[model samples]
Target: LFQKESHIPLPPKKDYDKVRAAIEDALDKDDYDDGSYGPVLVRLAWHASGSYDKASNTGGSNGATMRFDPERKFGANAGLEVARDLLEPIKKKFDWITYADLWTLAGAVAIEAMGGPTIPWRPGRSDKLENEGCPPDGRLPDGDKGAPHLRDIFYRMGFNDQEIVALSGAHALGRCHADRSGWINPWTNAPTTFSNAYFTELRDNKWTKKKWSGPPQYEDPTGTLMMLPTDMVLIWDKKFKPYVMKYAQDEESFFKDFAAAFSRLLELGVPFDEPGKPAPA
Candidate 1:
C-alpha cells in the first residue's frame, strides 16, 4: 500500500479561538509600536510565509524556519526578531501551538483589531526541526525596486497581479525603519490602523521627490509622508494600476481580496492531516 502524506492536524476550534484572543490581548498594549503590536505581528507572519517558493515547495510559514539560523539572519528578516521575542511569553503560555500557527494567527488577529479585513486563517502549521527546512534567502521583495522586481518576487509565490496589489496595501500599517529597509516612511498617517488610505493617497495626492540622503522616496506636498519606488509602481504599471484604482475607490473590494490572499498566504505549504489533526491543540 502507498504511504499517506504526512501533516499536522488543526487544533480544536475553541483552542484556536483562545490562542487568537491571547495574541490580541498581548498585543493590545500601550507601549508597543504604533500603540499596538499589530504592525510587527503582520510583518512576522508575512516574512514567515513569504519565503515560499512554489516550484520547489520548500519554503513558507509551515516550517517556522525563521526560528533557526541562516534563515533568521537573512537581510530581509533583519528586524523581525522583535516580533518573535514579543510573542515569546505567549508561546510559553500556549506551548502546544506551533510557532507557525502562532505567527499567522497573530497576523490575522492584528488585521482585525487594527480595523482591517477579517483575514480567515486556520491553525494547522507545525514547526519543523531547527535548521531542518530553512529556505534560500532573497525571497522577500526589495523596497527599492519597481514593477518587474515586484512581479518576480510575488509571482514566484504564485500570486496574481490583483493579489499582489491587495497585499501591498499592508503598507498602510507600518513604517519602514531606516535601520532595516533603508527607506523610512509610513504609507499612511494613521500607521496604526488598516484602511484603503494608501491607495487613496496615491491616487489623490501629488507625491514629490523628498530631498533625502538615504534613498529616492517620494513625499507628498504636505511634507509629512512618503512612498518608496516599490509603492509607486502600483500606479505606474498598467497591470497593477487597475487594482490600485479599484482598491482606492472601493475599500470593500480591497478588504475582501486582501483577506483571501492573506489566508492563502498562511497556508502556502504543508499537507493537512486527516480529520481535525491540523487544528490548534
Candidate 2:
C-alpha cells in the first residue's frame, strides 16, 4: 500500500528495511520480562489492530490512536505504553512512517526476528491527533472469560473460529507479568519465540486449577507453565478444540493461518490504495 501523502514520499525501500532492522536492535534487555522485546512489540501491534470495530470501522492500526488516553489507559492495555515508547526512536528516524503502520510492522518484524511467522505487512496507516480515534474499551480479549466470550470479541472484528485459534498462537511467545496483567509466568518454556507450543501444551498437559490468590488460572503438573481459563476453554469446548489439535500437530499450518489472520487484522478499517499486497522483504 502507498503512503497517504504523495508529496511526503514513502521511505525508500532500503530505508524501510533499515527501520525494520532497527526495531530488532532496540529490544529491552531487562530480566523483569523476556530478554527480548518481541513479545511486547507483538502486543503493541496486536493491541493497535485489535481495536478495530467492523460496524463503524473506527479503530484498527490506521490511526495509531492508542498513544492517547482511554486506549492507553485501558485495563487490557497495561504495560503497552512501554511498547509504544520503545518504538519512538524508530518513528524519529523514519519520521514519515505513521504510528499505525510502525507499531504493526514492529509487531510483525518482532515475530519473525524472534523465530516466528513472517507476517505480511505494509505501510498505509496514518497517524491520528491526540484522542482523535481511540476505540472504546472491551475490544480486546479477556483472560477470565470462556469460548463464547472469545467468539464475541474476535467475531466482532471479522475473525472466524479458525482465525481466532490462529491468533491465540501468539501466546506461545509472551509471559504474563504480575505487575501488568496480574497473571504471572510465560505459557511455554521458550517464551522468546513464536511456536505452536501453546496449542500442544494446552492439548497435552493435565492442567489443574492454579491454587493461588490471584484471578482464576491453570497450571500444569510440572509447575513449569500456566494457562488462563480463557486459554483452556479452547480445549474444553468442542467448537474450538479441533483447531487446537491441528495447530499442535502442524506448525506450518499454524504459521500460514496466523499470517493471513494477522495480516487481515492490520488492514481492518484501513483504506489502502492497494488492498492485498504483502510487506516488503
Candidate 3:
C-alpha cells in the first residue's frame, strides 16, 4: 500500500540546481567536436521532443524513452547517443529527475551557455514505462524535402507555418553530418556560438548545388559550408520567405522568435499548471 510520509524526505532542490550547474559546466568542456557539445545537445532535444502527433496525442518529450533500446536505435536517432552519453554524469548525479526533463534542460542550458536565451523549464515530466513509449522512426523532418514536406511533418505535430519556420531556426547551431544525414558542414561559421547566421547565409550566400556524390545539397561559392535543400525551401517558398528574410537582416529578432518557438516546441503536449507558467523573466 502506497502511503505519503508525514515528514516526506524529498531530495534537496539545490541538488537539482547543482546538477544543472554541472551540465552548464560540461557545456564548456573541449573533448567534443567543434570544441563544444552544444549542437549535438540541441539535436538531442529536438529528436526527443519532435515525435509528437497531435491527433493520436502520443509520443513527445514527456516519455523520454530514448534512453531505452528500441527507441535509441531509431534511424532518426542516429548519432544522438553522443549527446545522451555526454549528459550521463549529470543524470547519475540527479537520478531523481526524469530523462525527459534532463534532455530538455540540457538543451536550455546549452542555449544559454552559447549566449542564447534562458528557456523556462519545470520538472514534472516522469519517465514513461517502456510499453508507454517509443515513437515511430519517421516522426522527424527530413532535410532533403521542401516546404510542403516541412509542413507535413511539423503540422502532424500541430505547429503552424510560422512555428515551423521559427523552429527550423535551430539549424543555426548544428551541422548536417555526412555519415548521419548525408549532408555535411556547419550551417554557419560560428555553429558553436548561437546566432542568426543560418538566416544570414541563406540570404547572402550564392549557393550552387554541391558537387558531391552524396544527396543533393547547396554550398557557398567558397565551398566551405553546406545547406540542405529543405533549408533553401524557406526562400524558395513564398509563405516562409518573409520570416527567413527578417531573421537574415536582424539577429536579435531571430533569437527572440527562436526562443519563443523553441520554448513552445519543448512544451508541446506538456500539461501546464493553472495560470500557465511564464517563460523565465
Candidate 4:
C-alpha cells in the first residue's frame, strides 16, 4: 500500500542500510546450488542491470523491470527468480526501497559477505510500469563467443577492457548450469569465496577445449574445472591478455581493481551523489 505523505518526503537512508544488512544476513544463511547465495545475487544484479544501452537509455538498473512477466520470461533470466525470491523478505521489511535499489544492494551485500570489497551504493531508483519493461534477450554476454564477441557485448554496455576483465571475476563465485547456460562447473575451486582463484586457475592450469555435446567451453588438463570460450579468449587475445595476466599474478591488485570495477558495474545508470562528489574508495 502506498502511503500518501502530506508532501514528498525523502525516505531515511538508514532504511537502505538496514535492508542491506538484512540481505547480507540472508546471504550468510543461504547455501544454494553454488554454495553461497553470492553467485545468484551477483547474477541477479547482472541480469537485472545488464539491460542498459547508453545509446537509447531504454534499460538499465533504473526500472527494475525484470519484475514484469515479459522481462522475467527472457531465457537469460532463467533461475534468477531464485535470487528475487531470496530477497523478497528484505523488500517486505524495507517497504521504502525500490526493487532496483534492493537488488543492487543485495549484490553489494553478497560481495561483502563473500569477503570482497565494499561496493559503494546509493538509493533513488523506482520500479517502472510494466509497459516500460522488457529488454530484448541476449544483453548479457554469451559463453560461447570469443574475445571479439566479449568486446562487442560489454563495450556496448560501455565497459572497457579492464572493466570486462574485472567484472568477469564474478566467475570466482558461481558455476555454469547445464540447464541454464549449457555450461557446467565453477571456474574456480572455491566457488563461494571471493578469492582470486579464477585468475590463478587461468594462469596455473592447462586448459583444453572441452569435448562435450553442450556449449563450447574449456576444461583444465585435469578435466575438472571449466572456462567459457569468452573467458579463455581473455588469454588467447593479445589485447585483453595483459590485464588478465596482471590480475593472475597479483591477488591483492586483482581484488582492489575488481572491487572498484564491480561497484561501478552495479552503479551503471543510477545517478547517486552530487556532480563533484568524490568517487568510492
Every candidate's lDDT: 0.87, 0.87, 0.81, 0.80
> Of the candidates shown, which would achieve the greatest TM-score relative to the real structure?
2
Q: How close is candidate 2 to the true structure, as a TM-score?
A: 0.92
Global Cα RMSD, each model:
6.0, 4.6, 3.4, 3.9
Tens-digit per-residue lDDT, 120-148, candidate 3: 66655668888775877788888888788
For all predicted structures, in order, the TM-scores are 0.91, 0.92, 0.92, 0.90
**C-alpha RMSD (angstroms) for model 3:** 3.4
Off by over 4 Å in 1: 1-14, 274-281
Candidate 2 per-residue C-alpha lDDT over 3-45 given as tens digits, one digit per residue, 9 for 90 to 100: 5566685555536688888998887577647788889999889
Error in Å for residue 167 of model 1: 0.5
Rank by TM-score, highest first.
2, 3, 1, 4
lDDT of 4 by residue, 150-264 (tens): 8887887789998888788878888888787678888988888988788888878999988888888899987779998888988888888888889888878888888777766
* lDDT tens digits, residue span 103-170, model 1: 98899999999998888777678889984869988999887888999999999999999999999999
